[model samples]
Target: MELLSLDKLAARMTPGSLIAIPADYSGVSMAATRALVASGVRGLRIICVPTSGIQADVLIGAGCLAELETSAVTLGELGLAPRFTAAAKAGSLTIRDTTCPAVHAALQASEKGIPFIPLRGLIGTDILRQRADWKLAENPFADGADPIVYLPAIKPDVALFHATKADRDGNVWIGRRRELATMAHAAVRSLVTVEEIVDVSLLADETLAAGVLPGLYVEAVAEAPRGAWPLGLQDLYPTDDAELARYAEAARTEAGFRAWLDRFLDGRSAAA
Candidate 1:
């Protein structure tokens, strides 16, 4: 398979495409997302993680775009700040209560060209109750009382990933995490932004190479270092409480929010 270039990746990736972003909080990923927002595109489906959730608040508070919050938060909890309670009041944003596994299941269902698939274990839990979207019906084939989850096809139109390293051809080693491969198999298109683009042979040291999202799955790749800044560098980039607090205060009022957005969310941090 041929490797991809960043230009090719950007050209094919536009707004209105569903995406399952990595939970990793790479500064570069945020920049890429901000760029997408600036392009006037909408509709984003983020794979929930603590960091991704925070970034969502930043983007949402800035009024850059809108989203269906599906991670840890709930529908009624929309008004309840991320820093606050369990349930939202009525509506701030629609919550699509599916967890990250739903991300894999959806993509897998789509890739296989099936209408839906039964999830092995995610049943009879809070996820089921919180997710008003989940369809409930008797198992057509089974005689027992256990119900099945008919997860629909979830191939994101395009996917973006930041890898620890990549080759000029776009083959990457994205750490030990396996989300990228799951996303690639499920999506029609994929893009990878890596810290460096080097020779594919240099990838021998990666113990998790089997989990690598192959070059064929990648539609485009860019050599972008320090991309995971505000987000992280693996174990690095711990949560910045100050930034989050400032954001809550800034978004408390519309005028203050606008100013805060222009000053910081315009791509800079609270200190920047």
Candidate 2:
């Protein structure tokens, strides 16, 4: 895997690409998201593995997204993601409302190289009705009329996230966050940002190997310390609660969002 600059890494993400991103609690590449906004790339279709937060909102507010498929987009205790809520109401973004189970099933289908995966959780939900692509089928093996929702495979063009570290061999250490590995496996390729890079081989250690996403699926890597800032790396740092609160307030209006974004682009650190 090639080690690249953050901007150069963002440059590799072309317009109209389908990208899979993990939830806020997982490793989120906010640094790369900022670079993506700065580059002014457009027509991105995001697949939030299950849910999203400011990362998706920032892209939506910047008009970089063409479509978004997710269960929800909220700023946790801060409440609804302002930009996402605004875009949805204005009908500026195409939203494909899905559930956590459905999204995981779809990606798992891709991972298994299958056309579609069946899910029972969505069988009686409005999400099933709204998704035209999701089909309803009767179980042939069942004794009675048992119905299920068929979620089509979602093979994203790229999977992006941040991590605590990468070893010389490019194996990313994700701890117990196996969903990130699932994302990389389901996507065509993966781009990663890390806090640090060490000379040791992560895979050589049996304990470390269990939590590592092997470099085979990684297309590129970039060193970006505090890459998940405002957000947080698991156990490395805490989420910047003050910054998130500020963003939640500022992003409520167009002018306020633009001003906040300007400061962000200028590399002015947020008061945390």
Candidate 3:
């Protein structure tokens, strides 16, 4: 009902839940994710809207993911996402490799409370061939020449992410990154970690109101300073480039990943 601890908020998510996380460049609830990993939460079906990075890789490395639905997973300048790449290569992960628009359209379908959404393109692409769940058909509105791809709605059990701030009432400020709002709208529950929890309502200001995701959509909120660690939280701080580079290197091998995980968990524990 009130602001929860990171671990407590993570505990609200059941094992094997279909969890939707924000894109690579968008803010992710890494602090809450680390808490979940520490608590040994497993069998999660992760949906990385559009793309992913450290969040997906860390979950894969911790053996917490059963499936990953995303367009791509890369560490940007740090190179490929090691654990995700390894898992895909070893055939240890069930991947739904679709295009970015497809993922976004699926979420939009859920947001609209529709069974499916039709999008243009992907007529002869490998993405369409790989995704058996997707279907193709002649466009009803076309003159027998147009084709469309139908993406099934993706209604995640929980939407998890980090925000710049949240009011005491639990509404979060996501700024211009509206995909987080879409995730919250499409999921059954929305859990967020915020850099700051304020007493005043963000909606009182018209400028901030436009970007505020009302508490009605948010199930729980937790105050976690630097909650999006290693990833940038727009206007708050930049990504930890040095640490991301270290993660990319260490997660290259199982042995190296374990060592890195140990140090990471230890550091997290100390911080807690």
Candidate 4:
């Protein structure tokens, strides 16, 4: 079990690495994202589990993303993800547009150590047409009439996220968001940030055991209270609506976005 500083954990990632993050509502490691930005990390291929909001937007604004693979990037009720939308519109980043299920299926295939996973939907759609990597095949079980779509396994170089709690042994309690577990299984390494670290083993109790992501799959853990700021953490805190609104408005233009980034970086430095 390894417990490191947020910047140290971020240092473990290489430039242009394929990194996976949890969905918007899920606990996101915003502290780690800030740390990465502070460290001037660049060329990351960020893979949002299905969709993202502030986390993706911040990285995109910082010029850290070389590519983004996700279904959508929206700030939920806050509105559209400004930096993400701008980047897409400006053609600044490579986007591997995919559907929700297709992203999930790819991660699932990686978790199960499979080369590809067949999905039922996405036939005769623009989503299927855009992805030449996806292959169409005849179902061997049937009379070779039915067709299936196969998605390549999405084995990310790192899976980064935040959790409500972590034990001294490094096990993280993710509760019912089991997609995090699948991400850990699919990624080469899993880096996690938590609000707190408890002394007792999370797996020692039966009830807690069910929700615990075993430390065996985790590479490093960092303590980051209110880490999912600007976004919500389940049962912990609500989204920082005021800050998100400010970000959305400022990020509408490149100049305004740069000003926002300067303010954010200054605040982060001051806090540090």
**Top TM-score prediction, candidate number:** 2
Kindly list the per-residue Cα lDDT of model 4 for residues 1-272, writing each as its tens digit. 79999889999887989999989777798889888888898899989998888889989989988999999999888788888888888899998889988888899999999999999988899988999999988788996599999899999999999999999888999999999998899999899999999999999999999999999889999998988876779999998788778888888888887777777765442122
- Indicate the worst ten consecutive residues by lDDT in candidate 3: 263-272
What are the root-mean-square deviations of the candidates from the true structure over C-alphas?
4.9, 1.1, 2.0, 2.1
lDDT of 3 by residue, 1-272 (tens): 36899889988887789999988678898888888889898888999987899899989999998999998999988889999999989999898888888888899999999999999999899989988899997788887688788889999999999999999888899999899999999999899999999989999999999999999888899988988887889988998787777788878989988887887775542123
lDDT of each: 0.57, 0.92, 0.88, 0.88
| lDDT of the structure predicted as candidate 1 | 0.57
Give per-model TM-scores.
0.73, 0.98, 0.96, 0.95
Residues 130-196 of candidate 2 have per-residue lDDT tens digits of 9899899978789999987778999999999999999867799999999999999999999999999
Q: In model 4, which runs have C-alpha deviations exceeding 4 angstroms? A: 266-272
Judged by lDDT against the true structure, how good is candidate 4?
0.88
Q: Answer with 2 or 4, whichever has the higher TM-score.
A: 2
Model 1 residue 63 CA deviation in Å:
4.1
In candidate 1, stretches whose alpha carbon ends up further than 4 angstroms from where it belongs are: 1-11, 24-28, 43-51, 62-66, 73-93, 111-113, 120-133, 139-143, 202-208, 235-245, 263-267
**RMSD over all Cα atoms, model 3:** 2.0
Candidate 3: regions farther than 4 A off: 268-272
Ranking by TM-score: 2, 3, 4, 1
Q: Per-residue error at 99 for model 1, in Å?
A: 3.5
True lDDT of residue 66, candidate 1 = 39
Lowest-sum lDDT 10-residue window in model 4: 263-272
